[model samples]
Target: MRAEPESAPYARLGGEDAVRKLVNRFYDLMESEAQWQTPLRAIHPQDLSESKEKLFLFLSGWLGGPDLYVQRFGHPRLRARHGAFPVDDRARDQWMACMLQAMREVEMAPELYVHLRDAFQRTADFMRNR
Candidate 1:
């Protein structure tokens, strides 16, 4: 029923709607699973509303959709942006676990899930500052 071009991860993943869902699910786990994710969650504001919007916008561009994040906020110097957070090895692993849980809950396709898991793991690790 859809006519999206091949190879666009954004489209393949169901566009903005799916991306938003993924972001929401990721944050939900991060909030709900506080026992293990406390350190990572602490880096965020008490209210996650802004964080959700930011993640949605960033992912929209990162996934090959319209460049909403760059258009609105300029280049995503991700490392620089995240430098304030104390992301050590534990934080990276916990973040990856939260993301994997989110992807599974959102029922991502097997191939896409694997691809995203690997990519997210690398990205999460890259954010480690300690």
Candidate 2:
């Protein structure tokens, strides 16, 4: 039998455990990092538990592991969902900063690091309302 080809980004990213760590770190950075905490963290609920889970579910499917978010909540409608908040350039940049720090903390591969940084930038930029 042929050796299996590399799996999706999720597996390459170390699956649920790694993804959970990344998400938690992402939130932790948002809550603790001085540069991003004010604008970005201010947008989140005072408590981050639910926000953390939602991002985890979203990223799980986004990374091609499981479609938990869609399965549980239907289409993400991410922008619509986020529309209630003001997501200007400052917000997007702050979010990217937090994610980049989290990615580094997780020690992701170089290629995947660049890929996620760019992808996250695009997604975060697209979320901008201003």
Candidate 3:
């Protein structure tokens, strides 16, 4: 039997395509939005292609779909991987702002939005190294 939508965020999110759209929108906003440019975008490399792909893979598994990131890149080690960057409250907030905007722009369900907003906040907070 198929997993219930409530039990599977990936399905609730419309699967891989929706996830990719959210990731792409997040990165696009980070790249284009003035508010995120310094705190969030500056920390990323000039090209966002790989960053976009990695986030997509990571979120795919994180949302209870295929574990593509682990399959391709092993454990996420999110904090450690992000340790090299100068992430702080500002960066975290800015990142969350961009993601929240993307989620809203994509019209995610209210319940899922609340769930993901809280979860993303915690993860973004955990990524802070400075």
Instruction: At residue 31, give the lDDT of candidate 1.
Output: 89
Query: Regarding lDDT, does 2 or 3 come out ahead?
Result: 3
TM-score of each: 0.92, 0.93, 0.94
Clashing pairs in 3: none
Candidate 2 — worst ten consecutive residues by lDDT sum?
A: 1-10
lDDT of prediction 3: 0.90
Task: Please give the clash total of every predicted structure, in order.
Answer: 0, 0, 0
TM-score of 1: 0.92
lDDT of 3 by residue, 1-130 (tens): 2343557888898898999999999998888889789868889999889999999999988998888899999999998888888999999999999999999998678999999999999898888898
Which residue pairs overlap in candidate 1's backbone? none
For this target, which candidate reaches the highest lDDT against the unseen true structure? 3
Model 1, position 57, has a per-residue lDDT of 93
Candidates sorted on lDDT, descending: 3, 2, 1
lDDT of 2: 0.88
Instruction: Say which prediction, candidate 1 or candidate 2, comes out ahead on TM-score.
Output: 2
> Candidate 3: where are CA atoms >4 Å away?
1-6
